[model samples]
Target: MIAFDAFRDGETARRLAAAIAAEAQPGRSYAFMEFCGGHTHAICRYAIAEMLPANLRMVHGPGCPVCVLPVGRVDAAIAIAERTGVTLCSFGDVLRIPGSHRRSLLSAKAAGADVRVVYSPLDALALAQALPDRQVVFFAVGFETTTPPTAAVLARARHLGIGNFSVFCNHVLTPPAIAAVLGEAADRPVLDGILGPAHVAAVTGADAFAGFARDARMPVVIAGFEPLDLLQAILMLVRQANSGAARVEIQFSRGVTAAGNRAAQALTAEVFEPRAHFAWRGLGQLAESGLRPRPGFAAWNAETRFEIGDPPPEPRTACRCAEILRGLAQPADCPLFGSACTPESPHGACMVSSEGACAAEWSYGRGRRRIWKELR
Candidate 1:
């Protein structure tokens, strides 16, 4: 494992904080959205907003893989899991997410569905190899960071001549979601710049965001996950917003680059193609935002393997998760935030994952305000 302590240094964070304070425009609020759930967690965990000038704001976007997955998809996974002769394998993060009627894979497991949480796609592949008679489906859900692994597993299944192994691909692209946010800004809070996702950039490359930056006229700085990394990225964003210049910058030079991981990109391209449309939790149906198995991998696609029915859209409850995911609302602004939706009982998708904005705010920022008021 790499030693990341140098990037998380206190002096460096303070220095970046001071630089941001100096660069920020007085009396003008700068709203910069970080399009990664990991970034959101780092920001909230480190109280990055409290350290920043009041005029500067960090808007959370729908970058959390678990948080952005639509209820319908989760429902479909549950349906598959409950079927006879089918073994459903998925990442641990996805198992707890509630579907229609508040049903989760965990609950389905309790009711005797062969739902198993896996750490890696290889583990799911192994399960399929072990159970020759059973149809094993891996519930693959994530952004670009996790897609290549799914692709590799798919390729491996094909190479091994595994007929019973298949994947329920829910991998999504990041650029279209960014466009959706910028396009819908007229009715919502406008974003000045973006703090791009760390892992996504490592796979898709920093150059992938260049066109979006040009189109939206928004600065996107891809930063590492550390606190200091976030502070520096914020400083860069503040400087760009003040200058009215928009460009793509890479701050996480250690992991991400202009070209990114080409081999991984090639593997994903070979295995998957963009779906016509896919439903996101908050952003709704985004065109070419999702991926499905290619024609060569048709037999390995669970969508084609099984017959699933579409359920009507459920009524929007008091949960403001959709608004929060779009950066239009904060966790504190939601009526169900603390009262109806604590970390113990998350009422919406945002509260489900540790990286989620609501979970971060609730876990780190909840008692912080009262303490700050006391100190003041």
Candidate 2:
């Protein structure tokens, strides 16, 4: 393992910022999208974007799994929870995602559904074992980083012959969505580079992005959560762009490896198989963008066990979340930004998710700055 202190010094941050500022061209502007919710949280929490030169802009991508889950999927999960003798378990963030008729999993819980928030899949499994008579469904969502833990839970369920436990697998892939974003540049705005996900890279390896970089001719840096690490990754991308080099570089070397965690990868492969296509809230449908439990474990698959249909009626037309998630528009660009959609009562997925760009800007008090404040 690499030493953590190498990244903690403020001097490292200054050097990285200087390198980025020096390499940034005066007339040219670089738009690099960081494609992970955790990265979004790190950037806003540490105010990493403020450290970069004026020309280099960080565009938030559809990284948050909870945010990207379309309203219909959440409705399906909630419907399963509301069924008699069924218990729904999910992360706290997902519980609040609005469904049809403004009914969320949390709302279902309030209405007497057995909805429980769990930190890990194992916790849901333990609950299943404890209550053998009830059908326990774990609302599994995330990318590669959280897939192995779900796989581990599935393996335990099978080993223990736990028939009551099932999983609503909403796990998505990263590379295909990156490809979709690059393809969108033909009609929409073009992205110069990508600040790839650190947590996902730790599971799938930096090598996962090699194909995306080679095919799109876009430089991608697998970066960490720290402010210094993000700055250094930006500098590294600037250098690569200046030198006309398109490759995958791991700036967060302390946590990431070229090969990544082999054990976690193997476990994921063993339990899950890629779906032909899955719907994202903003990015729409992409081939092989999601995962389903393998046929051997179909008994524990909630989609099959619960018999959920395609999806119910979508949310109203007033929400501009689809555009906001694609990097084509901003939250302020939406008609209902602060007027109709505040943190207290969100109208769109962007405001509902904490790591969402609009939510982060609003909660951290960054977006609505007065001209006098800027002058000061």
Candidate 3:
């Protein structure tokens, strides 16, 4: 097994910090978007920004799948569960996210809905096999990194002739979301570079970002979810920006490659296809951004099997989750963040998700807001 202690070593982090400060130009600012919730959490938990040069900034992106999952989808899952002899299963985080009128799966369960939390899609399939009577729907959600496993479980369920297992596929494409974010940069402050997600790059490969980097004229560095990895990637971004290099680079070479796992990609393609349009919480409807069970797998599709309700009414809360996901605002920027949107009482999807930027900052870097104010 690979030793991970080196990646978390404090001395190495300080050395990397020194290198970043030395190389980052003092005359101009370098603002790069880290397009992964894991990286955002790492940055906050380690106080990486406090150790970096004053000229550098790490903008959070909508990388948390749970946070990006639109409220309507959660409403659909609740609707499915409320049906007689039907059970809805999802990852723990997805269950906590409030749907229409802030009604969560946990609340639905308390109100006699058969909504359960499963660690993996396979567990949902197993539950269906064991029950044999109740219809089981796995509310699938996440980026490319998670799609493959869901696909594998579906394939297994099909092979075993399990009739009760189905899935409500909410798997989204990262490239489209990334494109949407970059497109928004025209109106907002232009980002100098992009720190691509490690797990996403592992599935899509570093080459997946090559075209975007060349066309968008921004350096994209695939970073590992470690403070040292982010620090080193930040240094790489600084150098590329200084040299005027717009290209894709991989900082997490151990797990990621120019061409990622071919078997996983093939399996995923076999099980699912793209939806013409999918609504993201903050990003609105993105074309070909969401995934659905393929026609061949319609027998195991919950959306096709059940009658979902109308889309949830437009959220009208004090929450600024949309702004936070769009990189236009931070957690502390919202009035409800600490006062009303704590983890125990999440007023928004961002606070409900463990991978959300708002949750990361609230848990690890709330003091940064004060520091930022003092600096300003």
Candidate of highest lDDT: 1
Deviation of model 2 at 334, angstroms? 1.9
Clashing pairs in 1: none
Judged by whole-model lDDT over C-alpha atoms, candidate 1 comes out at: 0.88
> What lDDT would candidate 3 get against the real structure?
0.87
| Candidate 1, superposed: residue stretches over 4 Å from native | 1-3, 309-311, 367-376
CA-RMSD of model 2: 2.4
Instruction: Rank candidates, lDDT, best first.
Output: 1, 3, 2
lDDT of 3 by residue, 63-153 (tens): 8899998888888888888899998999998889989887999999999999889998889998998889999999999999999999999
Candidate 2 residue spans exceeding 4 A from truth = 1-11, 312-316, 368-376
Each model's lDDT comes to: 0.88, 0.85, 0.87
Off by over 4 Å in 3: 184-186, 309-313, 365-376
The positional error of residue 60 in candidate 1, measured at the CA in angstroms, is 0.6
Per-residue CA lDDT of model 1 for 1-376, tens digit only, reads: 7778987888888888988988887979899999999999998888888889888888999999899888889999999999999999998869888787778898899999999999999999999989999999999999999999999999999988999999998999999988888885567668889999878999999999998679878988999899988998888888888888899988898899999999999999999999888889888888999999999998899998996544346458888989998999988888877777777777788888988888899899654464456569
lDDT tens per residue, model 2, 102-185: 778888999999999999999999999999899999999888888899999998898888999999999998888778777755
